[model samples]
Target: MTPLITDPLQPVFVIAGAAFCVCLMATICSPALTLFSQILASAQKKVFYDKFARQLATMATTLGVLCFTTMAAGILHTALEEPALFEGPLRLPLMAALGTLTLAFALQVIYSLTWNSLKKNKALHRLFGLFAGLSMFTAVFLSLGLKRTVLAAGLSIPSSAPALDTFLAVYSIPAQSVFWPLLAQALLAGTGAAGALGLCYLLLRREADNYGRDYYNFSTAYCARCALIPSLLQTIPAALLLWMSQPVLSPFALENPFVLLWAAGIAIPLLACAGWMIVAVSAAPLRHKPAMITAPVLLVAGYAVQMFAALRVYALI
Candidate 1:
């Protein structure tokens, strides 16, 4: 029932963590969408490559830089505030997380900047984008594992091992029960958020760019499906995550109205957003403008609430 974070700087850390999550998800999704667009273009499909995919790549680079900076700043802040967290068993995993993120950011920038030059080498260019996404996903897994190791009690870190074995041990931590569900939940949520954001971006630009009705309609439908499918699929992992945390949360469940409210805050808006997106995709082109606009707003709001609630629960645990 009591608040977990009493520190005066707790608010600042929460804001920073939220910002990092948003930026990281956007970064991951942008590159993935870019790869999807490129595949469509390569197949001689009717995609607007320059306006849609290239723009997504650019956004990916920008968001990657932002995500990297935010993560670095967070690590530095943590090191300053709690130096012991970086000591002993925790050090290697944290380092690996940062190193992987750095690699992802570098690859993302190259992929974006070389898009034009790589026209003749589409395969290699796609590889760069692919690796960048993979790296980001890996980083997320490592970071999540490290977070669980830090928070959960009675997690043992192998000691007195050789350097290589130690590194492997740290990397393998996510395979344990505590971290995998969180990683799955994050990937699903990030994919859904990316799709929702893409839908909003397309809607905002559709008027000014005035791509033909057919193209605009296709793009809208694409983004809508992207947003809807993963979101619906996310429920399984979400339930698993909640189940995993029940031990920590059960004592307060009945006493805490806010917990239930936050849960509703996450689920209701996203379900409504998914319903609206269905309407947008099914209705006549641009006829359901309100649905198109409202879906993304609700999606983002739901995600924000979910992130806030998850952070609070993690702190409590």
Candidate 2:
């Protein structure tokens, strides 16, 4: 009698959403960091920023489209799996989430489309870019909050709970506790994701005739620096995520070998990849591939492990 979405393909959808979330956050944050990098950057560094900043914005906008689409589909699947949870007071949060998503999308689109054209009004353009990132954060925050509520409604409380709303309200206290962990992962992992992507792009262009050797070195260093911190911090939050889950100790979920296998088969390699990225990037201005280009492997593993684990925690399996 399992719901189709929850038991069958839900993991797939959630994993896809996570991947996009990582990409979107990374891309969105990159340009903002680039903007901030300007103040402290040398004249030579500033020139590099000026050339690539707009391209980052464009990439962010494109990634946002994929992020939102996958997220929307995930939401729909979750809603269909548990229709009752989305009905009452929860609807308010859902609507707010949609509102924030729409606003964020509009802002990002404008920011992307007008990147070069809006340079005439520097302050306004910067404001648009800044707000676009914030709006995205807000949207993700609200959506994840509601999702946690729905998940708790299904997995945490007794079936005889007075009302789903009340269960959600009370459950939210514990649920909200995980927000920091979630946010930390998104931001840090996003940065690492973006940095990894930047490395790939820079490595590809390292020998190109158009850009000077100095710019290449500068960009390689910058991207390496950006990738380093996130790679360092990401593992901590990821390790703590299950412990932070509301009602984390379900009888159904206890002592599951899948979790262990996932840890061994997936998380280990992911950590290795993260570590490799750090070491590779640390040796910055790398003219050739560093760390074996494991991003594709990590991406697939990330999608699978996250999807499988979430489904298990949510009792979707």
Candidate 3:
């Protein structure tokens, strides 16, 4: 008999499979959904963000489906093989992560639907981002810790050629040796955490400064939906890198430290730069046409790359 989550590879694989479906759904429907929402609100005569309430609603529905699938698989894993999976210290954290993720996604769905209805509720919007950040942070810690514990235990060692294949079959991702550069990754996390907090400040600043006006300039629905995309985008990469590097604490993909120097040292910083560019572009007076087009294009491209990387690492591609 298989130990539900005991087959560490199995549960991760299940999660990845569900995520694959979500990616397809997001890619195929997100644009269409956004367009539909705009059409529905054509008569609203609101700002661009306000008019996107329906788009957020659509995003919430799609993401809700994704989160539900993930939770269902996790619950089933826990329920079917409770004794094996629940006997250890890791059990509680695992369950906690799953539950939080479920609640976050569920709230996301509701938040998405009612953003327009709750447009003035800045406090609530901040709470949503708070929960989202909490969820991602907890998830990163627990899931990566669990994966590290398993790897260190030598429970899933390979003894054959095609080592990458062996690793994926048992670990549910491509072979990634990551135990050496722990400090760098930790620094990355620190940077990322700061960036995350900075974004939260950006989101909340409008409300805090505005006397009685809405804190979030956008409709509640649109803001809620928009909130999710960034959270999910950041979490997935962070989780994956964290998981991959647990074994050795180094960059997972590149063998040469120099290579890592470029990937983590250079690429990540560039991505950060790009993020700030978007922020500044969004706030620019007059909103230059080049910035307008470049910002969204960059964001969409970045998200697409992140999603594709997730799929590949998880072997969903």
Judging by lDDT against the true structure, name the best candidate. Answer: 1
Question: lDDT of all the models against the reference?
Answer: 0.68, 0.61, 0.41
Model 2: residues >4 Å from true position, as ranges? 1-18, 38-45, 69-88, 154-176, 201-209, 244-259, 265-286, 290-292
Name the lDDT of candidate 2: 0.61
lDDT leaderboard ranking = 1, 2, 3
Candidate 2 similarity to native, TM-score: 0.71
Model 1 misplaced stretches (Cα beyond 4 Å): 1-16, 49-51, 79-87, 155-163, 173-178, 204-213, 251-259, 283-297, 307-317
After TM-score superposition, the amount by which residue 185's alpha carbon in candidate 1 deviates from its true location, in angstroms, is 1.7
Off-target runs (Cα >4 Å) in candidate 3 are: 1-46, 52-57, 74-78, 154-317
Candidate 2, residues 1-317: lDDT per residue as tens digits? 23224455656666666666557677656655545544334355466775455545555667677777876897789889978656655556677778887887888788768757876776787787678778767776776776766665545544454555643564365544776686677677776677666666656545653577676666656665566667557767766766555364343343665445334433543653554445455544453454525663464466457556656655756
Model 3 Cα lDDT, one tens digit per residue, 82-166: 7655544445545655665556555555545655666677457435534543454444444554555464544643333253443
Question: Which scores greater on TM-score, model 1 or model 3?
Answer: 1
Q: Residue 73, candidate 1: how far off, in angstroms? A: 3.0
